[model samples]
Target: MNNNIVYKNVNLKEFTSCKTGGPAKYFIQIDNVDDLINTLDSAKKEGINIFVLGGGSNVLINDNGFEGLVIKIQNKKLKVVPTMDDYFEIAVGAGWNLNNLIMELTQQSISCLEDLYGIPGTVGGSIRGNCGVTNFEIKDVVSKVYNLDWLRFNDYNFEIKTYNQNECGFGYRESIFKRKANIIWETNLVGKKCNETIIKEKIKNIMDKRLKNQPYEFPNSGSTFKNVNLNEFDSNIWNSENLLVVDCEHRQQVPAGWLIDQCGLKGFSINGVKISEKHANFIVNFDNAKSLDTFNLISFIKQKVFEKFGVHLELEIQLIGF
Candidate 1:
């Protein structure tokens, strides 16, 4: 192991946005792909399980902690190349903060990512979950993604593989990275040039909407569940339930928050965790809360919503230790 980069029994609560979770038995932060390979090689030799953490915004960690090596990607390399047309490409590290990247793009008058202004977490995590709002998603701007097949570390094969946009297999709140053990190292995003004033206005409007709709005062992991596709339900069911249907990336969808609200789960609490009154989709840690408390509340919500609407709610946040 690279002793200089590795630490033992690091508290993971300090890393997560929710301010929960126990300590990581082993932890390392990698700033480059080469170092990540070397670290994975060492961990492989030790027979330790591997977990890659980015900005720690979209994860729930168990109180028992992770009994493995947690690798935090911190490579922040960035380069922008202008094309012949009114377009540009940005090559950024996986560890780059999503909000910071959007702000940088705004300063450069890039129009593609302005609508995604207020989202949290790293570029890698956003791509893994295909994070976005309304009609915009990380997949739309992604041109290419570079990652390492760490699951093959036992063979000492650490070659970097590049995937084109379609090969990413992006869907609603999902991507190939979510299914495969490959670790994203960097990505290339294509954007179009736009007026700086227009980009700023769009960002301001999106930020204002997020501040008004989301529960930001308490510690929480953004959205708890993924929205259901409208086609999954019968037309009569929608009319009978009086569910609100909205357009998402040209597809009709039902927001999970609205369903939770319909079930009367908003502002519900158990232990120190509570469903946010401001946003039914957010489960916030208003006080000191255990991971189990949040887990139980999530289970209860799924059951209630299922009983009422017969729709299964899928989690958006990654559960680590549990």
Candidate 2:
């Protein structure tokens, strides 16, 4: 890799949504698969560990920063082809900003992505995390995913693999990408052609709902923890705690935010970081907080919630370098 492409000691705070973190020891941005392959090969020769970053919305970088190479995906290629009557196949680059992609698709009368409006992050990051709201998940529209095998790259072997929707191993806030060393390059999504007016209305409704419920005015990663399955807890425990259960696609779930609020942690602060009073699930960087501050507060919240409810909250945000 050349100096023109690879940068040293690049600050990561500017890239992440939380606006807190140290720096990447080595950083490079790639807009094409060829560049990614070449970069991986170069990193392998240098014996450097690799971390792929997309829009940086759902991640927390440690205060000490990452010592390895951070590859930022910036590819934004998008193509839409009509596959059948009122049905279209959309091939999108992994790095495409998800919100922007949804808007563009809505302009073309695409329907499947309307509910995802106002969600931040890139296409690949959203798929890797299986990001969703209420009853709609990105997996519902994903037809196929194309990725590079990161594990093989370390062996100086460049291999590309494609996985159909079922093979992606998608679950709540997770996918095979989270468990395996797969670098998502592109994805194929299936959408139906709908009336543009109806699509826009759906987007507006979802956006309104998010604004009313989520604390969007502050700088924060979307959701701090994944909602727990209600079945995981005894029915008597739910009644004793007065835990509210909502039906999510036939399964009952208890919102993480509710648990945090029940523990009286909403608006709680440690240094400049504080849990959002508007939504307990969001820990916002209100006054130039340090990454360590957020980390400690998350630990505190977890301890308190577990002591009170006996439910351990799992982080929805990805922790990088920690």
Candidate 3:
């Protein structure tokens, strides 16, 4: 038991956007990398699996709970450095709130990520998932990522390393962090000097669109499924309706919400969990929903979409403890 690390029981439901999950047997909040490494060494000796938790968005934890240690990141340092003529580099701690960072930068007349306004979660989680909205992704502005190599625990040794944007392996909702299990410590992003008014308007427009289309009033993860790639679908069927194409770095994409809506699944419910009326891709916790409720609902949605459209809907949210 490292004195610098505090461990206790905590309900995972309180730490997630869905607001429905069981307790974590052991939990600790980390403020610095040294303490995290020390605590990891201690936990390794105890033979407990470590689960890192972020801002509690874009995840669905199981009802049975995590039996190991849950590490909540809390570091929140931010720094801006001038790089070139009009572009600047900003370094942010992994635990900083995504929306707050965007707002802070925009207020300073630095606007590069205004398209991602109102998205929830922490910098670490966002980087891990490569979170994005229509036509914009976090990877576009990322300059570098700082992370601790934790997989080499045999020597009880660890080293902090900086990864360039290309080395991060960023794709649509994909990154090296997902595969390497490196502990993200900080991120450096590029931003350009812009008019404050233009940034504000962009934020306003994006937020308004989200409010109008998403189920923000209910407890839910942002999007349940990843958008389908057009190449995966039959051209004749998908093109019949003129499928909306998203310009991604890899390939053309279609909206999962559109597929669900076409299946007439809006407002569908299984117990307390329901497909959001405003957005078919979102499953809302309208009446004290359980983890199983969402799980069963997602299975049902996948089955129906597959049957109707001959397309598989891949999940976007990370499933914890299930």
Candidate 4:
């Protein structure tokens, strides 16, 4: 471990939303670019595998502890700058919590992402996943992303480069960052403005719906898959008139939750790991759940869904550890 980095023999359960996983050989809570670069160098020198962890909202880890270094980002800061009428951009640190950031922004009458109501993880994680709700996604608002030049570590210490929306290949829950691994330091968000009272009311409506529909009592990541064509119409869901409704869309978008529910996966459990009863899309911790249990249940869902529907469900979460 690097003298500059801190942490050792730490359990990953506490950090992850699923509350699963074993201990990590080395761990560091990073707050800035320097710390990230230093830790990357140290990991390379030690010849250990590296896993960059955010809030652990959208991922599952192996029960066996990692034999490598894990870096958890925590640097969160925001700078609000005005650009145009009812338009503003925010330079945000990677570590900022997703919901809290939205809440703060909504309070300021900025409301581009009000519909993306409930999501887990950090801003960087959301960017990595291109998280969205309904038809809106983070990719639409991302003006630029700042990250290290290389995948692991850069001996040349590559300077941060910025890319506009065109360079990032973004689709439902997937982005260029999803395919690439690097330390993301900041992102510039372009948002819309509204009346303060109206924005707050909209946010309240969204939150109220969330509290009524989604379970907030226990920890769990949001939905599990991007819609696919193969698994569409399992229960006559898209049986409307001619148009696709995500429409003109020849491709079908399948919802994994509906399938899981059909497969009797709701409230399914493997030890302490349990699929959320309220929302089949969520996986919850039922007291000291181990990583393996979570892994097993997820596997079980996939197997059954595949057997019945002949389509595979892709994961929305990133897996880090063992």
- What C-alpha lDDT values do all the predictions have? 0.88, 0.88, 0.87, 0.74
Worst 10 residues of 1 by lDDT: 149-158
Clashing pairs in 2: none
Report the candidate with higher lDDT, 1 versus 3: 1
Q: Candidate 2 on 56-93: residue-level lDDT in tens?
A: 99999998889999998887889999998889999999
In angstroms, how far off is 197's CA in candidate 3? Answer: 2.8
Error of 4 at 17 (Å): 1.2
Candidate 1: where are CA atoms >4 Å away? 1-4, 234-236
Error of 3 at 308 (Å): 0.8
Q: Which pairs clash in the backbone of model 1? A: none
Better lDDT candidate (3, 4) = 3
Residue-level lDDT for 89 in candidate 1:
88
Clash count for each candidate, listed in order shown: 0, 0, 0, 1
Candidate 3 ranges with C-alpha deviation above 4 Å: 1-5, 154-156, 239-244
- Which lDDT tens digits does candidate 1 get at residues 163-188? 99999999888899999797899999
- Candidate with better TM-score, 1 vs 3: 1
Best by TM-score: 2
In candidate 4, position 114 carries an lDDT of 64
TM-score of each: 0.95, 0.96, 0.94, 0.88
A best-first ranking of the candidates according to their lDDT comes to 2, 1, 3, 4
Tens-digit lDDT track for model 4 on 189-289? 99888776887787688788877766678767667555556435445433431223242134355566767877888988888768888878777787777
lDDT of 3 by residue, 186-249 (tens): 9899999999999998889999999999999999998999999988888677767667777666
lDDT of 1 at 302: 96
